[model samples]
Target: MSNRMRIGALLGASMAFAFSMAAHAAAPAGGLGATHYNLSSLKSDGHYDRFIVTWRPGSAERANPSLMRQSMGAALSRAGLVRATLSAQGMMQAPVQASYGRRLAIGADVLRTSRKLDRNEAAALMAQIASDPAVLHVAPDVLRHAVRDIAAPASLRPSAFKPSDTEFRQYQWDLKAPSGRATAFGDRNYGGAHVNAAWDLADGKGIVIAVLDTGITTHVDVNTKLAGAGYDFITDAFLSGRKNDGRIPGGWDPGDWTTGRPWQSMCTDEFNPPQPSSWHGTHVASTVGAERTNNGIGLAGIAYRARVLPIRVLGHCGGYDSDISDAIIWAAGGHVDGVPDNTHPAQVINLSLGGYGQCTADDPMGQAIALANKRGAVVVVAAGNDNDNAKYFSPASCPGTVTVAATGITSRRAYYSNYGRTVDLAAPGGGIYAGDRSSGEQVSDGFVWQAINSGATKPVADDSNYAGYAGTSQATPHVSGTVALMQAARLARGLKPLTPAAVLDILQRTAATPKVAPDHRIGAGILDAYAAVNMAINSGGTTSQATLLGNGVALSDLSGAKGSRTVYRIDVPEGAGKLSLRTSGGSGDVTLYVNRGTPATAEDYHCRSAHAGTSESVVLDHPAAGSWFVTVVGRTGYRGVSLVGKYLASR
Candidate 1:
């Protein structure tokens, strides 16, 4: 794909703030911008009772959208879309009906079924809709919900521990996880990213990190980190419970609670019980920037000095990917008509929520991510708490994102933290447990701590707040906060802003793998924020280094998926006879090669260390006179490797 053309196809230049405003066209209504999908779907909590059908381009609907929706309903009636859908789904005996709505921005119309049909039946109807030559695309109005509260308990237990005055710090057990050991609070010690030390160097002064979840509450812990009134991307007034209020500009949480009565089915979900608004965004924002040591306030944040951009994508019931994608682009300083220019464009964005689906090239989430990356925003995503392969989740699976997994106090991958090749790194996702009285008080801490609102049923910000939550949702902010710290350090050092790719590279290269046992599923390894920031600040962004070699000196640098040659200059004495070079000590396979004279390019190499496996060796039968250059290359995936050189005297 021509990345240039795809990037140029930015919705920022053409989409309105929301679909209703599509007619006021400085841009198309800010529906799913540029995030076109041949067939995009969602995971609804209620049921799959609605399907959206778009009239194909060149169809009569192209000329008269109003009459077209009307005629299609008549045509589908004659064609019997409901019966066809039922029969095709082998639900011929099932009660199914259809009602059509007006034209949608995707050039489609909504077709709500009588009752919630099974997911298979909805897919079946969508298949039938696609076959109509007058249709461009068809997909379920898939339900999308908050990634948190997969299961929120009726009541939460606030820990009894209190911190000192210099630090009102709650037990941030995620900071250090000692392998195979347990903390005093009965939480396991495992692979933590070492965040405490990282905070000493940088506090994310000017960077803005956007949190796209329920929305932030007025919790004192993070009150000062607000990055203006971030937009509420929830376009549906009904879902937002505020009639006539569409995509307003504000970052406050209104609450997302539901009561399950058929007459008022807004809170009813076939799979889950009634739940509170979660205040998920507030909790996550605190992890990234709650003022620590604030005259004995609550607790400290990863980047207390950094500000947060609050964008609400999830509300009552759940949310749609269409709205979520729009918020992503807008947060990265991209344009969305009707939404004012973001004064605080975020350098980093944290998505602690995701829906169940792969982020393919045609997916809107992927497109949004691409736009964010193009605009210099590093997107960090949670790998999900499903304990399944992270590759199946949206933005997490999307390329150009830093996908993170969860590790507990014991420094091991959390039991519920999803794993796979797609995950980039792991951080402290709490595994705090309660002691089993029957089991002689075996301690287990099931969550991580941060400040939250006082109300359990609704979000009511209270100063006296501190609570714990678990999930990769918690792990993600850890990575995002450190990224802010890294960026802050970079700025302080007068270095150029780090691109998304550069940020990922430095974090991965500096990560420390556990000595206990290596788990490939956790990406490079557990995060070491201190080590990462150190590298980002002191390394000066050099991919390779210049070096002077001794007779037997060795040089090395960590190479990534893309092979960057680590070059070294060697001086040979007049009496030097033969030269030998090789590579060893690396997690990934690599090769070493040498050139006789000062060749301007890597292609001019005269001999190579082509021996196989990770280590390669080659010897020159005779010696050359001038300065010699030797290089090590990552033959495969990225890894840290060593290149050794030896000059043998005449034998």
Candidate 2:
């Protein structure tokens, strides 16, 4: 065998907002900008005429059908969009019209305009509609695509490893423990999630994981027998590819190719190239829990015994937040009118999809997540492939979600993985580069191998197709699968499942320290599956919130030796105005590191200060609230240091 081998090509990870749009001409800056709309995710020429509106709880629009129609009509009239109907050519006609589309599970309604509007036009229209007193929130119904990878053509080689799965030896590098020993394949990656060690503790039995993406396809390595009877949530007739409006019965991928006609005219541009249907949902599902894992055929799954529930939310170009939000609630067993209730509620929900925007508890996505969390489902989301801060992405930024960033084989943050204060942890997302270093030819060890369809435009049933993919889309499943294992391990002991908060805490607490520093703060560290599973098995059944440091309180007379580190945590509630942490009157050179959700470290922190003495300060304006961990590292030995935390409540 050759010392260096190329396994497969890079698959484009489908983004909630197509990263390709960044290369296009500047999109129109709508008047007065937007309060709820995420214009940054739209393409220069992208068009949309639909808006999702959530009515105030006690508003007449939310209670009476007649009043709701009147309210919508008044808003359209004020916006000068009297042309509510479209011409035969699908063009906007005079006498602006607006109509109700569908009701969302989050108590929001989808509103369609006369025709598609560009960025500026959509913003103006949405703003006008939002001005209505009954409308609590209104934003364009932007499409969201799979956070999947682009496919590269290649062949697999033989290898020697344990487990009956044929691909486990050579291709499945992500499942094994990190190693430093050199071999013909080169130095082993120090970043593997260590899933193999977790297998001894649990295989995710009696747990259900729901994957929200492009939908599932036929693959021999994947067993859907234990899966829930899934549903398709795309509502547009053209986008659904079903030619019928409203959601359907099964979650099947009938190809989401955008190569021809109006789709290309409206959704695609020079930067956004036309492409084939990516078997994104299938790949994600396989990673979570492949049915025939150790049976000696293809690859292995993280939680092989966990039931996977496939819920289709992406189709054609992408999907709408309106549809995706509803799917989120339904996947967690929440009620959605018109659709039958989910019989197999997922213990964990994997969202390998995201869009550009910050989310809040009031937004459709946020509301849905709150419901999911209430139902005891841990929502795991990809940090995004844009290489930007995860805070700029939806769902990932949404509170209560376990936001995950990607890491390469070396445990370094994947070059394309989003980084910021919001990330929860890191997992194997594939680097495409053999080593962490950039500027080199790609190698096979950089990709995460899994089951996928070979068909470019459509499904090729029963074909044992597999490929190497890279993206936060791939990294997210690793965590979701591990969550299944942890949950199952607890259940096997005749104990109640761990709460979402407890699961996150255990995963963060047990994560392995990164072998090397990533360019940014990806999270607490690379996930340690074995440690996490073990901790889950041993933890008490009850879960509680972490302790909060007192506001304006000071810890006096603290001291540490050289290179020693001390950590303190503070709880910052949502809507905080300012957060300040400072060390003064101490005779030592120390560095300060702070991050939300997990303990702060030199390798992973959102804010840091190193200014010669103990009189250093770190201040954040409108910081995101959660558990903010502050670390004081002794650069040189000293004593009599005092640390104080001051917070300004939002007025």
Candidate 3:
């Protein structure tokens, strides 16, 4: 039979059920009478049904191993038999209609049945089979299925922040301007200044960050920088090949026209089919790694050196978990049997999309993310746009993921942005621009620069080439770009492959701390590309050194003690080799302890000499994966003695 017909028949047979009330019937007279059991009760009660039967070994002639196997096979082929397996002396068989409460057996001189069973049906089934004359023993079959429940978060707010004309022009200029060349204009356009500085270092060669959202229309800015293109997930086909008459790519490509409309209602809209919404993904992609001042046609991205890998995941209300999970895994260089491999594997996965819901570290989506991390992909998530604090959202709440919140130009929390301790850091998400020093009507002070999704036929908004959008969505790419920048910096320095932890450390440690207190909403602080890249280059260590000093010696004890000191030493054999340290508080008064070819010191001696504060640890070089010993000795007995440390080694 054909595959489809075979599947249909299987489904039909599996669903068919017949109930009848019949008294126990006598077993058929034969060499060994066999009885069947029903296991429906076991299934409903979350149990397994099993049966066991034992048969005596007979003489060689009577045993006839081949004959016994033939008999078992024949019984298994019977109409109701579901499965059968042979053991040493007998065989066990299960029937499709077997119930947990019944048991039967067939043996040489015995035909027995157990009282209606209870609890473990699998155990009861085995017991019944054991009492049979022709059978050895029966047991429940092992089965497994992939089961997971993912809590989807609430929807993100629609992009509401728009840049002013002057601000827009400033950003455009920054994109076109060269690095280190001061513009005749003052720092009034510092936003563009930051982008230019980042691009100067990026040199535009890195991983392709995939933006899985709406379909991106072919605009000058986007087309000029296009590395390659693929289908928007909604279409289930390539967006570039839709309506082409074999010459020009053409078709009914639905863009982001349904932005303000409800997803459900848009189902019936002629222009908005169940296909990729245009602008959302495009805009997000542009913000992440748009092409910089090459031909100077559009805005610049934080990682001007990086490329984009647009993988549309959102359409209609929102994409499904299964699809998003697939996109995430695929984007991170994972292999999915049927789908084409993501040609350009993304080192940084930017999720500008999120929803409301509690997601634990163990959820399937979280598991998939963990898998991505194992493969060296850094995931950046938006801390939802709900403007709430207490609740956590999916993909963001996923463990080991970098969740970002939104901040305005003044370094204040954006009113529409979400907040919580879960937020790792914040970035310029735009603010309510109070129109020109006069009318205070709230307008959007564009803080985000990205590509706009124009419909395939025309630009959706007047400023289709480029526009400013503000949200935690926009903020997310800032962090993603920083991650890319750090990676590129590490590459340029010839450092080891950047791990997720190292990336997070660089971003958090060098981030620009806001000027205000209780800055909980904005997270660690605003993103600082210069500081982060500097950290990567400086932290890439090529030398190895160990020093021994008494307690209360600062890292200045090792160096001259003038500049910022980043060094660390450890005593655990596992933490020896190369070390880096960073000190806060006093003007560099930390000390290092090495065994120096002597026998190991006592734990208390090491702890006491180390000042034993919680912040101190001994880091090691990369290939120095094994254990090593060194100690961190604090300089002062004063109460607040804390220091941070790390190390890098040759792999």
Give Cα distance to truth, residue 63, candidate 3, Å: 36
Q: Give the clash total for candidate 1.
A: 27
Candidate that would win on TM-score: 2
Q: Which of candidates 1 and 3 reaches a greater lDDT?
A: 1
| Candidate 1's TM-score | 0.71
lDDT of 2 by residue, 1-651 (tens): 112122322223334334534522343454214554444444454577777788888887887756766776787676666645565479756675667787888888887766666665565676777778777777667777777563433533344223345457667778888875442357476888889999999999999999998888887778776344899988887877776788888777777777766576756655457776677888888898954687767678899998899998988778888889999999999999999999899999999988665666767888899899989999999998887788767778888999999888788888878888899888998887768554365667777777777676678876566667888999999999999999999899987788787687667666666788778888777888888898778665222333356888998888987555678888887899999999998696677878888776544578887655689899999988788888876755758998888889877
Candidates sorted by lDDT, descending order?
Answer: 2, 1, 3
| TM-score rank order | 2, 1, 3
lDDT of each: 0.63, 0.76, 0.45
Q: How many pairs collide in each candidate, listed in order? A: 27, 21, 69
lDDT of 1 by residue, 1-651 (tens): 000000000000111123212212211221223232233233322246656555656787556746554554554454444353444356654445556543333334556666675543444455555555676655455546655522223243333334333223335556643444555455445555677778778889878888888787775546634634698888767667677656887877777666433213654533445655567777888887754544455566787788888888877766666677778888898877657877788898988877555665445566678888999999998887666677656667888899998775555676667788789888777653342111222132445666666654455644445566767888889889999999999898787777787687667666666544434387766778887787677643233455667778776665555234466777766667787776676667555557766522223457765433467787776677668777655434656666677887755
Q: How many backbone clashes does candidate 3 have?
A: 69
- Give one digit per residue, the lDDT tens place, for model 3 in 571-640: 3333345654434443323333333233222211122122222244433343233323344332222233
TM-score per model over all chains: 0.71, 0.79, 0.56
